[model samples]
Target: MAPRSRNASAPTKPLLKAPAQIGSLDAAALVGELRQLHEDAEDPDIERMPSDNELYGALLYAEKHAKALAMKQGTEAAQRSAAVKRVLLWEYLREQTDLHQAKAIEDARAVKAEWADLAPVLAVSTPNAAYNKAKRLQAARLIDTAHGDRRLRRTPEAVVEAERRIAAQALAERRAEEQARQRHQLVLPVAQRLLGHRDGLAFDTDAEDWLDEMAAVVDDCHTSTQQVSLARYLGATVRALARLERQTGKPPATTEAARLAYSAAVELLSR
Candidate 1:
């Protein structure tokens, strides 16, 4: 028998995944699909396939089939089919488990989990055992083409590389947050003006919904993508309030503050 590489048969998830279920899926059919998924993972154009939940459900059914095979409850052909399904399912599960174990270890490290803390949880003898295990998993590089392992050891260089990747990912997230804060400056005055009059600022029934929505939308705008649409709302409010100022020539105090917010909004939009 040949020794299986930890990542050889593990497949990357498909791009567009649906809910995975085992409704009426039998062991025979699942075995065929298990082979197909392994093959499809090698194909660059594979855009769609069954997700992990489907395979997990199939493995549960295969377990039942395995019990029947043990009791000699099926015919020779049926027993052979069951045995093959069990083998394939076990192989798939083993590969998937290794990939996820590496990820879980990476996640544990993110929260400052030291090797000493991980040893007992990983069922390893000592902190060094845990460190060695992480190093081996880190070498696999499954996301890279499945040609060869990077063969990274638990040296300072290898640990630093992993830590660098983690830090870069965290920096990307912080950049996203920073960009959103800058974008929301476009409506920050509108939010503040409305908040200043936390009591309803609507001068009449017609302006009520727009005034309330302008404030709420700015408050809820946490992402850069959402800022553009919310700015349009603030712009419309400015036009409406400006018209109200022209018509009445003596608008209420809250309306006056909203008009001031319009000036701030104009400066932000010009930027």
Candidate 2:
């Protein structure tokens, strides 16, 4: 080492890149872009698969965005389904010791099962799951209270237990009612495209009919409905009509003609 080397070691470069370009991309932005790309690839027009590196990068980016979307959708769906479920539960509670109450509760239980099935797909995060689970647990407690068949009149012990149960039930009912009120106040417009409204008339009933068909699909996939066999069914109809309306494409003879086609297809499947 008689003469020290001019460049004994390579010049050290900053390990991190400059913050300017990266500033626009917070973690959430990166994830959302990746998801959009992934969803875009599902289109029929996309012929070739993206490279493995691209796919991997997209997946890594998507993780952060997952909880926000999943939880929001899950929560909204849960609240909507719960609105119907709770109403049914209330009716059942009032009719306890009556056979119809049992039947109605069974129906609500089925709806609740669907709510459970869908929640995981839509939940924003684990905390969303916890919240819904707690709500369900509270509802269960109320049902149990209304149906608790302990002979309170026969013994002091039974009487005390029944009173305690009543107190707990009262508290739960209040909480559930409050939740329902909060949810009730939040009225979101249903997707206009999904409802089949032209220039805005009351398409809510039509949408409900369509949704009922969707619910049936969840209830029984083996059976197809003219009404709504699959979630994709409505999506397909909407897309087809849009294509028909394209300037270069042939349009349906009339709006009535398009309606007939949609209605006929749904009715045939529903049967």
Candidate 3:
């Protein structure tokens, strides 16, 4: 008989590891390595690249290995290697700083921060200077191409494109925020009503003790992110309640308000 095709087989290995427990890593060991490396091979551009964790780690690893290699060379060659490394890093950071600075300005404007507030931080003498710097950085990020090494164009057309993009982003954020607020306002009352019967129906039986904490959290919430847990808790609780009710010939809620709340909570579970 011919052997079965390997591709069609169920296979010999387990498909999952539940996160695959391999060699373990810890933060203290990684931080110790970076701290030691920084003592000798410090790169100032590391701070400028804070938004990119993966890139920062890769650069640090590359630096560690390359610095070891450079040390094997004579002193003069090592110095030259270090100089080239710094210059190449500078070129990369020069491009990235403009992009990140532009994003920071957009984030500041999103929170209604004024140029006056940003002037000192931007290292500028006046609010006008700060605003102009923001515009320049903003334009630098959108130019079609770099004119030369360290020379990025800020043409009128690029500035217009940047302005349009910023405006659209701000508008979308506002609309999304408003929609979240509206949805929260609508569902919040229903959740509160369901919790109103919590003492009489929910706590009477041995349901999870977390309902108490969830009630307090929902009561104090102001944002949609904070409010998500209440709906999720309610949805899960109602499903459990339904299963219990079906297994025994008894309803989860006996009182009129509670019966209504059970149905209401279940109906909005998918929402």
What lDDT is obtained when candidate 3 is compared to the true structure?
0.59
Question: Which pairs clash (backbone N, Cα, C closer than 3 Å) in model 3?
Answer: none
Ranking by TM-score: 3, 1, 2
Could you say which candidate leads in lDDT? 3
- Kindly list the per-residue Cα lDDT of model 1 for residues 1-271, writing each as its tens digit: 8987674321232112222222233444665554343333342322333344567655554454343333433245655665676676666565556567888999999999999999998889899988877755654432221223232333434544555656787799788768767777746665566456635343554455566666676667765656756766666655665566677885434556645655565566667
Error of 2 at 22 (Å): 80
Q: Among all windows of ten consecutive residues in candidate 1, which has the lowest summed lDDT? A: 9-18
Q: What is the C-alpha lDDT profile of model 2 across 42-89, one tens digit per residue?
A: 423222323334533434333323333334333444334434433443
* Pick by TM-score: 2 or 3, better one: 3
Q: How far is candidate 1 from the true structure (C-alpha RMSD, Å)?
A: 13.2
